[model samples]
Target: MVPVLREAPELSLWLLRSPSPDSAAAARLAVRELDDAEVRRAALFVRPADRVQYLSAHIALRRILAATTGCPPESLRLGREPGPLLSPRTSRPVLRHPPVPVHFSLSHSHGLILIGTAASAVGVDVQRTPTIEAVRVVGPALHPAEWRELLALPEPWRPAAFAQLWTRKEAYLKGLGTGLVRRPAMDYLGLGTDADAPPGPPGWIVRDVLVGPHHAAAAALAVAVEPRITLRTLPVACLYDGDAGLPLSAAPLLALRRRGSWTLRWSLLERDPPG
Candidate 1:
């Protein structure tokens, strides 16, 4: 049976730390769960770390969908045209047909990985806090009104406020699938008067996510109603343990046995900073 979410208008965010033996094991399990094309794409990654990150993110997404759809994890097909979607393979216009009710986005920064899933179209972004000088260099490119407003902020708060604004813009664009191709300058995301509650584009709801003191993250959903997000750290063992009837090979099982218990630290960004 498909498990229903405990909260309405809620999004699920899963975080995974840097690659380790346990993560590697989890990646292998993820590989087993993926379709052949996905496995081929994963194998093409030149860097082992990149491969692990891709696998871990996709694995967590599959687990989430499996729980929601009551489908076997391995049987749930996922594809990336630009954003996450429930499809057999990667292709543009995955949404040209009936829109997939489930939408998701993924972002990774430094060693932290974030995956967000919702019933509506969603996008997420994470960025490391930029140096004050870095912010100054790029600040002018923002919407003129936004830049002017940012300058009025107290000096100490500028960096965080800028980070918040930047991520929100990025998340919104990502949701739109235009990325930087659509001039951000043309859009006004309010960062000047209110850092926590920026004026997002109409029809989209934006929220700043607090990953930690050093990093900033944000999410945008294509719904008027603000989404309540639930964040959790997914351990490698949990992925293997909750295979949802997916077959596992002996090699991955051996790897899991060799690795000791793995733990991840997570911080919830329940609220934005007081404006």
Candidate 2:
């Protein structure tokens, strides 16, 4: 399971609903609350089925982000990999906040695409339980030893761990903004693990995050804070309504002990790497 990390000053977390809610009113209600600019911006990528879902998720994100830093909606911008596109209206707020070089990564499964974010270089990823066949098809990211680690895990946790590693690597990719264009093995290994891999792509802090219980996830950021990976679970309702903007305020969020697909996270954890 990707452990959820909350309370990192260097990093923050947000969830984009795979679907807005049971009713269209919930989706539309969330959309109407978004900044007009954010809605128009997301429209550029809207697909036939993506129209409603896209609006609900992105708009929710903009509201939450604006609330977090107390910045006006007009000044904030969402990046392609969930990057921060804050325009600042002018150069002063741009200089003051300097946009913080936020990075984001996303993945979906079982109708949910979990997202995580951080400053500068950051990566986030999500996956539902891939088929047994899919596990065999992961390519070179999993070395012989890593596969051994996966195999060593008990039956219940194996698939979850597989999802974790895959998402962690993918999150690192998103952090690099290279997507799948670059090979993760060539860049990182056991990302959130104690293996002592390189920091991150040029000028980024290398961190990992696990969001859900059955799910695995990793995030890459720019700053090097001793791994204070805090994890929390927010409900689809609260996330879409922009309530997750407050730090460590997910007390009202659901406390999911187990789920088929859960998010996980690994920050620059406080413990020393195993040597």
Candidate 3:
């Protein structure tokens, strides 16, 4: 049996890289904990890559929540709630009958998945750097000031800049529960590099995350005061053992050991200055 968590952290973020094509059998075994609805949803994806990404993300989310809540991963009930205050039809993921006050969000893009858990509402997103054409196409849909800022950036820098802004915006919106259904252009999260965060939503802290050089990631939490953020990456091999992705206990230090070279390390990538 997988060890259960004695207490949930105030805030935490986990990053998992999707399995390579060669590890198909282990990847399939890793996601056996997903519920029937999740399995159906994953099957709906037309592309094989999309299906794998969905499977990888849901497995990680369930395993993490199971460890924290002491609930069987397959038995946990997850559902969508109406986002923010107004969008009645927008879907925001929430625990149906959580054993604790746990709020979480999940996002996956181009084989990278990010999951964030907190005592209060939290949202996270990861995205591959947008193409220059993508930036041009989506730029005008963002806040006017953000668009102008994108226009001002050097041609080569625009994709990264837009990606950072997009992740922050998505994270905040996801926390709000409104998502893009509420219109992303309504909020103005800026591109400034100073310590102070650019004016945007109130009562939430959004910050960029370092996930190596290929992807731009960010997480948002609804807190009056900023708390320390714990970031870690799980090697895909850990999932190869069983449906329990990380073999962890209630101890403060989260560790995973496999028979050979693969292991889990709770490394804090870097602490970015608080906004």
Candidate 4:
């Protein structure tokens, strides 16, 4: 047995987190596990830009697994989806082999990076900080209730409007295992995802994260349960510096890079920040 290390029953979830995002070595390591070249051949479909992006994110997630179980990183593969939210080209050995019920998610906004892996439906979102003007412009595009809510905030507080909305959407998508291309929007009513959360989404649960100054983030539980997210802030220098792609792990989030790896120091904080 891999040992059930984490179980977030409330969210119907199990989580894994890693601080470093091993970008450089991930491609080489992951490919080695594949028995055929089709996985690599599939890479041709993904634009070079997107191909590289997916690889970096996958490697980071693999390393998170390695750190915990002492398993090989690339040995864990990315799931191939032919659906609308077709993911970046990568390996999926873990699903076939030893059956590691682990699934992963990746999100990046500005330079901050976030990745998540869980046994249940998981979602995450990261947004670059917005300006008050930008929030004003985006408010109309948002749901009517969100529009009124944000519009009512003071000028300086407006910047946070988009950030909060973006994070919630991102987190919701991550939980669904579908990227933003699916067009999922945020529910104005806050769900009590973190016990202290304001009434938001009724069916789903969400929590905002402050991993970096210029970043706003959120994560969600799937349709199964109303999740309560416990925030984890790892010592990912990339988060603070906005240059390094340093990853975060713990509670299902990991950071991987193709180059130098990071052994992150993260924290699990219970917070109820008033929105």
Candidate 5:
């Protein structure tokens, strides 16, 4: 079901478990909501699992945007040209469009999809907790200070700590729309006593979100004031049931006959004042 935001939420997050593609009809239904470009991108995936993840994330993104903007799911156009922006405020899908002022980010990992939206530029990322080997390989390349603090953690806790830092940095970069093109090592997010604190950078707020026991997620927003973030899980059944057009009050009833359930998680990080 689509979550109803009382006001423009400082940040709104939606999470959905990816659906299996074994049901040919289900696979087709997922793609039907996507535009031609998205369809082509989904088809480019060599593995069925990869394709399913891509389609599910995109479809979930559209539905979430549709619900908030009071538009049809198929009408919104999702793109990465300027970093995951949506367009054309209309109720029905169209081939042409005009720009709408909205900022969003999307990430998928291990059959889970996450979408974040806000009035200001926003970025979010999700990752499965990393292995020791994986952390060992990438740890040194992180901002020098952050790496040192990570290594200082107890052996068993380092992997998860590293994942948390990585997600924060990635979310910041995604929010900036520079992706990895901007060197992550150039920025210090914090370490040791400051691990939960906002990074050195100005004008951005980052927070760690608890997605599940096995996964880590973080969100970053480019805004002047400290903002509150709300998280909600929309049932995958809501989209397939053709309920995207339903009013917000009817959302709860749409949570029927779902093969999986959604778990909502939230985190709030206020910006650190200047020295």
Candidate 6:
């Protein structure tokens, strides 16, 4: 069973891999879990692969959120808060139904989707490591200190190092509710080699997420001190059954338990009896 929602910030991070290309029918069925707006948005994707990814990400997000809130995935109301000058990039995601307050953030890149949940405000970002050429073009836009650190690294090491700093900075920006409106060069989230480098902005905790060698990810929380972060993987096939594209026949039963004062252990069951 999902742990009861709490007042204090307890961070949970879930990583989901997108379904294979041949699972088109199953993808179509999973779209039922999304709202009309999400369905329309998926339709807007010109590439069939893009559409599949968008569907997989949304379905997994709703199912995971539903598990925690005990509400049907389709019943979770999702909307965006208006931003200054009506900029869509600045608009923050808000959930208004079931009256159970929880802060969540979603991010996807390539085949991986990351979702972060917490009692207090939170933000997350994931990125496929960029090529050396791409890194050279965008690396300078990061904080001057970060840029210098990147320059100091060997040529072969720059891509991964740059991705690490980039994800951290983006996570912080999303956490601040400013997105890219706040200049990336303004904050210092460095490669940790510099003894003088500042950790991050005040009143926030930023940490790197281990997504594997091909990708980099990070999460930030709006709290004075860092909280224990729990990481779990959700398999795409578990969202539905076979090629029938039926509704979550084998739901992921995440049994979360507190082993110590701060450790969270997640046991992923093979199948959950229909709730």
Q: What TM-score fits each model? A: 0.70, 0.60, 0.81, 0.57, 0.76, 0.82
| Backbone steric clashes in candidate 5, count | 0
lDDT of 3 at 66: 85
Candidate order (lDDT): 6, 3, 5, 1, 2, 4
Backbone clash count for every predicted candidate, in the order shown: 0, 38, 2, 34, 0, 0
Worst 10 residues of 2 by lDDT: 87-96
Comparison by TM-score, 1 against 4, better one: 1
Q: Tens digits of per-residue lDDT for model 2 on 1-275?
A: 99987644445555444553355444533555555666676668545345555554454455445555667544665433222322222111111243445444444544444555545445666666666656657733565446656666665666666776777666665665556655546654443343544444455454445444444556555554443333344344543334433332532322121212333333312221111
Clashing pairs in 1: none
Winner on TM-score between 3 and 5 is 3
lDDT of 3: 0.74
Q: What is the lDDT of residue 220 in candidate 5?
A: 88
> Model 2, which residues run further than 4 Å from truth?
1-9, 16-25, 32-53, 79-107, 139-145, 151-158, 191-210, 236-275
Model 4 score (lDDT)? 0.48
Worst 10-residue lDDT window, candidate 3: 253-262
* Model 4 per-residue lDDT tens digits across residues 210-238: 45456676666544443443333333222
Model 6 residue 236 distance off true place after TM-score fit, in angstroms: 1.0
Estimate candidate 1's alpha-carbon lDDT, on a 0 to 1 scale.
0.64
Angstrom error of the Cα, residue 128, model 5: value is 0.7
Q: The CA-based lDDT of model 5 is what?
A: 0.68
Clashing pairs in 6: none
RMSD per model, one decimal: 10.0, 10.3, 8.5, 10.3, 10.1, 6.1
* Candidate 5 accuracy as TM-score: 0.76
In candidate 6, stretches whose alpha carbon ends up further than 4 angstroms from where it belongs are: 1-8, 83-86, 241-275
Strongest candidate by TM-score = 6
